[model samples]
Target: MSDDRRTTVPVWTLATADVKAPGLPAGESMTGERLAELRGVLAVMADEPIVTLEAHPLPDRIDRGRGIPLDAASPLAQHLSQFITQSARTSLTAARATASGECLYRMVVPAKVAAQLGQGTVRSMVSKAGAGGVLSPLVGPSGKIAAHASYVPVGRAAAVGTVGGAGATAGAAAAGGTALTVAAPLVLMAVAVGVSAYADQQRRQAIEHITELLEQLQEDKLDDERSALNGCRAAIDKATAILLDQGRLGVSLGLDSAVHTIDTALSKVEIRLGRWRSALDGIPEDAAVELATLTKAFPGIDDQGGAFRVHLELAALAVALKRRVVVLQAVEHAQSDPGNPFENFTRQLKRDQQWLDELELGVAAVLVRLSAVKLARPSGLRPVFTPSEVDRLMNAAHRIHQLGVGVTVDGRPTDVAIEIARDKDGSVTVFPALPA
Candidate 1:
């Protein structure tokens, strides 16, 4: 360990009482907390913040110290002795305040756990720990380094006290503003700007790709007279793919990992769509049979009545799908335009992406329900969907409308709760349950 090599990070004190424990391995009362605290002390030695450490308790291992007895007769005395030995070992490596007004300390532990403690406290830890290139992994007691903890502190946090004399404050201030101190901040700022610009360019490229795909979807869907279903399906599939790709990009950009909700919804929609299409394939023949029975039971009602009912059900389903895809398309150009490249990061990108995801999920769910419909001719030759289904679709549409096509919320969108209501024309309306 060297004075100059130690990483500069925040420091905190820990009480021996706080370090006591029912240790990690179910019965190990000393090692679990003891190990973590030891790591924390090591981090402090590296001039990094000593906040807390996450304990990785090895399982099915002896909880007691090595070569220790398990006799219940003197268990307490044995445990106390072990604890004292551990404390002494820790103190040997802890930061020292010398008479010359200097602080010096060093310790070592498993590199993986050490890295976790170092994250955010010091940037160097994140890179070094994550890279695992400069240091070797420490093996614990589990016979392959998994159960044992071993580390050798290779860095020390050392600082000399400022001299106390007349005009000390002025001298210290002048010394603090050395070329290194002034140049370091400027260098860091420049690097930050460069990274921000690079991120902005990547974001712009991805968004541009999304917009191009949306445009293609729109152009394809223009001819809705005959190929509405095919066009809508094609568009929806493209949008889903775009979202999934963006999710991967987001993870690469450090927005989040594999647990993105948007990506999950897209996958679910694709699977459910296959099932929905299967359901839809049987609807026409089923509707014809149901209509024939209705005509037989009611002689006055002609086959035209059944035909109209089937047509309405199919139209409703098709329209719902189209709207869902279109809503996704609309968001493409609707989000907030990118701001200064040097200022914006993935946070803004994530927000815009999440808004689209929520809309996609809601609309996709509506399509799922519509696809599940049996579509048999209604008794009165009316649209087969219940009032609730109609209302649900309408509400889904409303949510999409509120979110819009933009990255920013343009319309002071209300987060309203709605109830099913019938209009004068007997059509369903999603009336707001909460008063204005």
Candidate 2:
């Protein structure tokens, strides 16, 4: 995550399809108009300023030949060309899918462009792109399209800041012919010094903020809470060591262990929450109706007495742990080498903080909903959460789940391709697709 090594960029997969031209049939090359139409469809789907696009043969179909580089005269075409080419080169799954007439059109939009165009506009464009059979027989009835977005890390040159500054300084100096030659080296050196100092200052500020957050978490009283907090601290320390080039190999070994500790803790809480939610869902219809009608506390009512209090505590703890993990990830990204020029680290950090805030609010709202339940003392009653309350709590839990603790469902990261097919009747069906 060192500042000199990786630069993260946002990428969007506008559309991917296994195209079959019913009109052209097998072995018939696509006509110019059809190709243009297909390209236009891809353009609309992307909806963002494209940097490049290229096509590659899917792995099984690589024997068919290399990818075709399309002409980039049009803006969308040019963007598509760059995006497709990058996808083919960078992702094995994407590369493999390119063959056999499967087109995986991906685009990497700079943060600036994403900010300008916005996600709402992009989504609207995608909807418009999919509404009609723009490519007709080439990709209409038989095509499968799926869209996704992800972030990618790219390397940045360590000298980028210095070079950029020096260039500006040189440009200003150029007006004085002889003076320019004499001032060039001094200007370059000055620029380099300024850039290094600024980077160092930014890095220091980020580290200080992360360290301060870690300190607050370390004050937790519970043993499990303390352990999770310690893991976060360790992970951040390891990341810092790696990024700062201090004991990198040794620190790297413990990094995963620290991350795993946090993951294991979060998983346990998730499981408990899931079981609690399931218990609520399993309440009998009669019991739910009775509970809803009860206006006052009744003895022996609420068979799952105290359960609400316990689950709420667990939910609060989960939120706290997740907040730490979020900060840990931000540290990793914010400290990466050379830094991502396209990314606004402060803005991203603020967004993560905001998400964590929303998650806390959601859990709090669930707690407020629980206040309506009238728990009765003693045993033997068949009372449970009211149907409406159950529904509300379930919805809140779902929102919390959607926010996620950054845990991958399968415990490891891997791509799963899905095929989304739209029928002639306008109905759509989606299912997982096996890699070729």
Candidate 3:
């Protein structure tokens, strides 16, 4: 079995047999089924080497009720004793008295292991014990499945060779067995609460990280592309809504499933955001300015500038849309898992398709300028291609390819040097290209 299906709690405190009724028979025989059930419980409790067991009398000193003293040698007690003897020991803390009149013999067991118990056992055990079962942390409030108290009702056992035992003998023989039972449903509820709290914490941390990344991009000045800015804003809103909605809907019932959902969602968003950051880092403000300069200075370049600018605009837009796609994809996967409530989804897939179109067009334009086309200007009229023009277009194509778009630049590439000067009117002028 997988670790998740194995067990959760590793330690237990076996407590019970607080006060037997006075004047009862010296011994009572348990049903074979009940004996087997108890044995199965003991076997699981002692299955792990790291598990610690502490045996203590429930309600150590009864202050008010008139009851017989515990036998301390009953079948239940013997099973626990033998199990403890065989299992590795851990340092146990001091034992204290339980609530008065509480008759449940409590045994802390693992959740997954506890889940394996039959409903009949859970029901009968609780009905027999006179107390309630509840799950409490093995350590602090760590929202991890640790220890759960399970109560099993047991009757007094008869002493050997005591045919007409006295009241004292009966009381002595019945000392170890108690008729305490606690409700198991309450423990189930407590376990749910702990798991939910842990999932909530994990979700919150991921949300904070995604929000931080979005906010950083929001603060940047991408004035040239207002549409891209607006798209980014929309994406942020969508991502925030996605996470918040998941939180409101609540985590899945199983701890492992809930944790896996949270982790997968977090991973998808982080990966998408990581890719966006990388794409943005490659295109600096100077690259944008160089593209703008090329548009004004290169002949016939301004005609194609609209397409080039749109490509850059889409690149910015993609930085946000890709993240939104990841968010939607993650949410879609969660909702499709037969548990989540998110039913309707309209994914933002158009962004990726549009990005591919823009990247292809931009790269083709750069390659055309580099390999196929030559300047058409007459003598003394200045050449059409400048070093800065080649450098700017080549760099832009490289950036596009780095963003996961394929681009082809065939043949031996030559470097061209071109000086740029700013006129008094704040216009950029490119000088003649130097020899390659």
Q: Per-residue lDDT for 130 in model 2? A: 62
How well does candidate 3 score on lDDT at residue 129? Answer: 24
Put the candidates in TM-score order, highest first. Answer: 2, 3, 1
Query: In candidate 2, residue 72 scores what lDDT?
Result: 27
Per-residue CA lDDT of model 3 for 367-415, tens digit only, reads 3433222222223455577887666667554543343323332212122
Q: Between 1 and 2, whose lDDT is larger? A: 2
lDDT of each: 0.27, 0.31, 0.29
Pairwise lDDT winner, candidates 2 and 3: 2
Find the number of clashing residue pairs for candidate 3.
13
Weakest 10 consecutive residues of candidate 2 by summed lDDT: 118-127
| TM-scores for every candidate against the unseen true structure | 0.18, 0.28, 0.22
Best by TM-score: 2
| Each candidate structure's count of clashing pairs | 20, 23, 13
TM-score of 1: 0.18
Task: Please estimate how well model 1 matches the true structure, expressed as its whole-model Cα lDDT.
Answer: 0.27
